[model samples]
Target chain A: MLYFTAMSDDNTLYEDLLRIRRFEEAVLDNFPKGVFFGTTHTYLGQEANAVGVLDDIHSGDIVFSNHRGHGHFLAYGGDIRSLFAELMGKTTGVCGGRGGSQHLQWQNFYSNGVQGGIIPIATGMALAEKRKYSDAIVIAFMGDGTLGEGVVYEALNMASLWQAPILFVLENNRIAQTTPIEMAVAGDISARFKAFNIMVRELDSSDVKEILPVAAELIAEVRSLKSPRTLILNTYRFGPHSKGDDIRDKHEIDQLRVERDPILIHAHRLDSNHKEAIELKVEKYIQEAFNQALADPLPDASKALTGSINHQ
Target chain B: MPTVLYALNAALQNALASDERVVIMGEDILDPYGGAFKVTRGLSDSFPDRVITTPISEAGIVGIAAGMALRGLLPVVEIMFGDFITLIADQVINHAAKFRWMYNDQVRVPIVIRTPMGGRRGYGPTHSQTMEKFFIGVPGLRVLAPNTFSDPGDLLSKAIFEDNDPVLFIENKLLYLNTIHDSNRLSEFEFFEQTPEPNFYHHSKHNGTIADLSNNYAPTCMLSLRDAPPPVLTIAAYGYISEFAYQAALNLAYEYEVFTELVYPTQLSPCDMGAILSSTKRTGRLLVVEEGTHNLGWGAEVIAQTAENLGSRLLSARRIAALNLPIPASGPLEEAVLPGIEHIIQAAQKMV
Candidate 1:
């Protein structure tokens, strides 16, 4: 049950989380100043969800992201420079400046074209992988807000009925932008897929120690089902969703953090001094990554207009 | 010799005959009832196992095709109508367009989306819609519309053979049953023991002619702007309206000595800029003709871009696309709403 005893020592995981937090902080610091025009839905507080899940993901296993996908993209071994380029809308960006932050993509495995947009895309990819990988699976990250979209449920129904190799990871941070989960969505969410005979699970997401094992178990169970499965990761948004807002709702984020910080949950479980050292190290790492991102060149003013229309 | 649908059938047959890997998927594309348009006809008999039918779910069909293509299976998924394409637009735009670029060029969504577009049969709004301008904004998706059967057969062959990207092949319903021959070149599928010499081919002539009526075109004389009498305006059109534009332009030339030229485009998506640019250069004034509803329609793009690029220079520019409304299902109402020769004449007069 204790699959992820303490990954704080894992250099790669810590570096990834630290890098994401810092990178996004830098994005926020520069956005209003006209330094970055692309809309970046920063993935700050949900680092553990991305790292814990993506760490176990095979490189061959296709990954799709929602608007808040910086964590998922970076955790899934995507390069940081391209991520930066994407936010800045540069030709060197993954999509050659065509797709900005929200549309960051590289190949079929990388479709950030719309919100909840990549669910069916992931299913489509899973349909491709079903015969070939046999063992591997497609993991799609969806926000709680996206469940309302028709295509999400449609793709899920088709995936379950056909028994496609897909894992629908619902990142229910309890808010769809400004609307709370209870306000935005109604009734039993798990029963949604269960009605279709697809397996569903909801887990407390603040604790990676708790979250990671559940993920591994559900992932295994879904893989065993060889059918579609939905795992709802009930986390909290610690940041303002993005940097544009300095304050997330008090009850929505502050109260949750006081009760359970994704990093704090893991840190508390470590040795007292070891926890202090991790905090210091993570702080130092976040600070440096943030600094580097700030120092990074703001995309050229012409970059935003690069891919419009060719009249000349 | 085959119609556009027959050409689609020929392409499917040729590709299936060449590779066991090709599979056709859509609604009612099976043997007992070839596709709604009969493009997949006879192929069910030729390749029974490869032809698949599904519940009338456009989203599910295209999503599955996107999946199948990733697995290295060439699935030419067909939608019953162009209007139904909007149901699966999210899948095509989000997945088919972004996959290869999102994953760092790792996954190839080699999907060929085949569907029929446009209006002529009085099907009206729900059944008659065109999808070119909207899809052009999608970056990773390659859009192609065929003017003749050979283009579909050859372009489809290339889409299936080499291009590892997603391609959208639009077939006009009018073109489906109409017999067409290209004097330009021979399709790879059109292998003739004795090839017709290029010089010997004659352009189909129209003596006081009228364009085909089945495609919603009006009877009009076809001629170039250079031959036109002194006229104050010109209009460009594509598909069924090409003929109407020609007719209206000729009438305008005679009635008011107004010069007008029709810019006929058989290809819709990735709109033919070459012809549009050249025609705009000559007349210096344009009114695009489209039968689709006006709001967020195809001709809007032409107007917008022309205004942005050539606004200051051109004499004037405007779009005469259909008024925004669900195309009327009734015969008379649909005809009134869609563009015709009379509409072209009036548009030319107003512009002049």
Candidate 2:
């Protein structure tokens, strides 16, 4: 069932995970020093879920993500330099500094700050693909927190009813902002999707070996049947929800960081030399991206009105 | 022969037949149900694959339509009622209306949201309301309301096929049964020809004393009685209220010798201020009417723009709108609050 079993393939996946982790670590390192004005939700522990799910996505396929989306964007080949510039609010940013951390639209990838707003939009995109008779499927990524929003249920109903070619990926990190999943959501999450007759798959996100094959299967089934499917990745976030908001017990986080670290788990499967080489390359690339982004100037105030409204 | 509803149906039919990418999505819009208003009657049957029957999720419908537009499909979404628009405001205002600008003009959301608005049918507080004023201030949204002269079919076609921006096409429940007055009583299914330009002085007096600058195409329309002296008052209105304003103008000309000029603008968002300002300068006195609540209504914008443009040339500018109260379900209470011909005439008489 495993789609990628080679040592080289594992190294590639390990490298992808490291890139997202290192890039976000760089962001966190700079944010507290006033190098970046606004806040960002770091994707520290959930890197494997993004890389695993995105590896199955084609160039033509579209992906939409929620607030904790830096990992998803990066896994889908988002430029590190543009992302750094965006975080710095530079004119060279993907959205021309209009969308800083939470809002980014690059090529076929889109992310929004709202928890469940993008679900219906991604469902609609899947519907469009179905209507066009194209095999392209859409992936909508949200956390366990998004289950609280009514629009997610509405989107699920429509996606199933229309048999839209979409894969709904829920990264259930067990915590929403500061609230635990059990505190905010009720009953079984997979059962909720099953009520709408959607096929569901559950995977432990810490294990990339399992996540990649399962995500690949679900994505293929979605494209082949032109129907909606759900992949629930049981993941965890190592960092606080955002900068300066550590509500969880530090002891528990530290324990999880040691026991369920996705990077550490994936690194064990790779050769030591290969892992070291990838780490060094990712470190150098992230450093260069940060330097370039830091050198870029902030957008001019006079051009503020340029992108406020479309002229044509 | 062609009512506004039928004209709209013809326009949709044309759009579906012409463009393979044009799709219609709404609740109960499939064949047999057609739509709540039957504006989409026989459309689903004609193009079964293109017409979509969505669940009663306004937010989902609009959000999906924006996605469809982003992926290179022209989606025409119908929200059964205007009051329900509040549910989808986040998607429309935050996503659809801002996608083009927020994405740095990399994408165009060529989507049209069609919904019926206004009071008259006693559908009650929730159903009977004119909320188009809420969307007029949204920068990227084009709000269009077709009156008797401004062909709904032509404008709907323009929004679906011609324009590349997101449009809020507001249809009045009362106006659905009415046809274009100058359409030569064409068949209900026949598509009326769109006029060349939006601004035309259809009837101009030889002495230039009475000019009827009413173009069938443009959002703004100016109507006056035949061979009347210069208008003492200019009455401006749009949507269903424009019918009342026209009637009041006729009464002012015949009964009171007020010689009133009526201006109806179909485009509400980027309002036709030039046409309104020119009429205000000639008449000096301006009276605006609307069916929406008086506070911050479309009439307020019209009066503000006219005053800003004409300044001292405007002798007196006033607005007559529905009382600032929630539309009640009771018939008498609804009539009590809504602006009518009597209110328009009385306001004009006072202004003049």
Candidate 3:
């Protein structure tokens, strides 16, 4: 029951998960040597949320992500080398080095460093697609930490009233940069969306198999109903908030890694030899991306002076 | 004569009819009510789906508009009042303005935010304000204000269709009722198109030839009393106050014999300083009049730019702007604090 016979190939999903894992591992492992610019939020334990939800993405659909977005970007099929180059502030980067870490844009996938800001934008994009009769739904990802922003509620209200085709994904990592969700969030998170008459679906899982089917159903409902839906994924983050800022107990993190590791949970379903093959391929792929990004030239400093807005 | 409100409404109608990508979103902009200033009157009835009436969330509205613009839609958002723009500053400054540059030209936010600014009504402190100064220097954003000289509709069309950046289109609250002037209406003053060509002013100075109207979207206009003596002072102004500055110029020539020329540029940021500089060089003295507060305002910037360009050639310079104080609800207090035609005249006399 965990795996869907009609769904994506399990090997491909496992490889996708491994790619994010190895890419983030490369980021963390290379951070000490100062190979990257700006801070990064690694998706060590929360890889399943991205790989599972984005499995439902159709062409012309929009995906809006937050600061902790590398996993989501990789799952959305963003170029690994370009993402690496972007983090290194090189010319071959996704945003040509202007948007270092946290800010990335490739095709219909966009990410901003600001929390809760992308929600309204996503709602608007969904509405735009609906107006065009394109039948393209939007998937906007936010964190439990972003619940503190009042604009999220405003966007939810508008989205419900307008019947915008969007799936609101709340990745509840139980922590917001050292602050626990219980301390920061008030009342019930699901009720917040329900208050605006938006359909709510909650899940607590680290396995991509479990998340994939539920996310697919919710995404289908959003597309068919042409209305907003909230999918609150209660998850765990096994890495530092951003480059060695962890304040949680090491023993608790180690215990969570063993019990709630998404990669480990999914690896049990795959053959050992196949898992090793994916690990090796992802390792080589991530290493080549990192090395090529490191070797790429930095963006031309002179072009930074020219105004992006029309100066003529 | 068409009113400024008519021009703006026509612009909206023309944009919606011309392109399906154009959308208008605001609070209470629907039928029967139109907008607060009626600048969006008759738009919703004409294009129901395009003119959207939303909740009272300025930040959310602007944020949504930015999204729509990013996805190949030209969204023209209307903030109920210019004062309410403070609530959406984060969305406009951080998101709309920074998207193009921050994204490294991956996308463009072609949104036109139309809001009524300025005070003459008794709408109190928060309702009436010339707050366009705050958004002037923001990169990847353009600030445009239309006056009586040319068609404001033309400029709005250009902003919505031509420009690939976000434009804050300011419509003065008092100017909504004022009449737009054509060549016949401006017969008392000499009107000439400030051509975009280089050294046109220098050529005009040598030959004394008047240039015909050039088809420019937001060209600056220069005006002086017909057959008057050479200008001794140059006055710079924009938006609703530019009309008063023109009147002050005529008053100075006929009534006081000060002989001043008025330079009004519709585009504020990335301000076209060519006409202002040429007039200042001829006049030797410059005076800037604005309705915004005096500190770090539009007048200060115009003065600063003129001084930077004509350091030694500038004989004298002065800025006439509103007093640095919160606009009071009382009529007399508001009038006393805001810069008026008398202020421009007095400032011109002193500079000359």
Overlapping backbone residue pairs in candidate 3 total 0
TM-score of structure candidate 3: 0.95
lDDT of 3 by residue, B1-352 (tens): 8988888889899889988989999999998899887888899899998999999988898888888888878899999999999988878887888888788887877788989999989888898788998988887778889888877888888778766678899988888888888966788788876636532222121132321112124778898888888889999888999888988887888788999888989988766688899999999999988889999988788888889999999999998888998888999999998999998888888777
For model 1, residues B28-82, the per-residue Cα lDDT tens digits are: 9887688888888898898887777766767767877877776566778888888
Report the Cα lDDT for residue A245, model 3: 91
lDDT of candidate 3 at residue A12, scale 0 to 100: 88
Q: How many residue pairs clash (N, CA or C atoms closer than 3 angstroms) in each of the candidate models, in the order given?
A: 21, 0, 0
lDDT of the structure predicted as candidate 2: 0.83
- Tens-digit lDDT track of model 2 for B227-321: 76878887888888877887787788779988877777787776656667777888898898889999987878888887888888889988898
Per-residue lDDT of candidate 3, residues A1-312 (tens digit): 232334578888899998999899889998989889989998999999999999867878899999999999999999899999999999999999988888888899999988888888888888888888887899999999999998888789899989999999999999999999889998999999999999899999999998998988888888878999999999999999999899999999999999999898888888999989988888888889889999999977777646434452
Go through the candidates in order and give the C-alpha RMSD of each one to the true structure: 8.6, 6.3, 5.1
> TM-scores of all models?
0.76, 0.92, 0.95
Per-residue lDDT, model 2, residue A123, is 88
lDDT of 2 by residue, A1-312 (tens): 434422228888998999999998998888877888689999999998988888867789999987898999999999999888888888888787878888889989988887788888898889888888887899999889999988888889988898999999999999998899879999999999999999999987587776887888888889888999999999989998998787999999999999888899989988889989999999999999999988998988787765334232
Of the candidates shown, which would achieve the greatest DockQ relative to the real structure?
Answer: 3
Q: List candidate 3 stretches off by more than 4 Å.
A: A1-6, B195-216
| Higher-TM-score candidate of 1 and 2 | 2
